[model samples]
Target: MRPTAAAFRPLTHRITTGAAITHVHNSSVPQARGILTLKDHVYFAKATARGRGRSGAVKSNGDCPLELKMATPKIIGGTGDGHNPEQLFGMGYASCFLGSLQLMASRMDKKHVAEDAKVHPNVFLGHPDDPTLEGFGLRVEITVEGCEDDDVITAAHEYCAYSRMLKHGANVRVTKA
Candidate 1:
């Protein structure tokens, strides 16, 4: 049985890393609520260093805010209409795969000979009738220059976590083709 609101004390948990930084979250309150109270300097710094949103994500106060979409970049096509969520999904998946590969390489202490690695990730959306989001496929082709066969293979195997997150048995079929 779940605890009643009257019984809830709004427990707080703090995560501190060796006098460097501290993060606190209340499980009962919404994540957005009291978020401003946190001294999120380190979090902001990390995001900024990674070239992520610096100002911070703005919240929508409206009941139904206007749906704004970014024009798709010229490289992917679609008249630079960023409105297509599919294009965004494709880009996200491709970038995620490459990131995972790089992370794996770093963990293995394998140095990349080339500065940049190429990863082509293809994302296919299922028919609208398939509300389960089934049959959504992703194909990633990686071409890393100056990397030996052993390191490349190890990276590939280590990066399988991305595919593992897909809905179980929803056909996240991967092929080297």
Candidate 2:
């Protein structure tokens, strides 16, 4: 026997306010709150890192454990075993920016723009000359390939989440190659 719509209705009532509800057929609930909520959707990602800076390791809690060996260069007085944080950030940003390009392309009805697009995110860590300021800062250069028209590329960059997030914080530049 299959469950009826009424059977599932009660289960949704227990959901807390502001929490994402996976399924809600009754439109009145959202209207009453005067708020828009993501329906039938939830996204989550988790990871844990250990050890010293640059020379540490990280693991994700997904079905497949993603173990990463992190290390620094000999110039920094450390063994360059695997990869550094900047490289990892660049890799992740590149992939995410590519997805952002696809998203913008679809929204703008220019899906062809992203068909063969490639994103190269270059992450650089540098120290400030000012002695008062401690630690280092990052500079990013994102190179896009397989697409022309600088205006369209700029539009896509404006729509990219990574670009938006880092724009105010880092020296981020997007260019065509």
Clashes of each: 6, 0
Estimate the lDDT of model 1. 0.37
Candidate 2 per-residue lDDT over residues 35-96, each given as its tens digit: 22334546556777789877889888867778888888666678987778788877887888
| Lowest lDDT 10-residue stretch of candidate 1 | 1-10
| Candidate 1 lDDT, 1-177, residue by residue in tens | 111111100112232121111244432342211111323334211111111222112222344433334444455443554344445445555566566656776676764632265555444433333266553334232333334444443444334433323311122235572
Report the number of the highest-TM-score candidate.
2
Compared with the true structure, model 2 gives a TM-score of 0.66
Candidate 1 lDDT for residue 176:
71
For candidate 2, the 10 contiguous residues with the lowest summed lDDT are: 1-10
Q: How accurate is candidate 2 locally (lDDT)?
A: 0.59
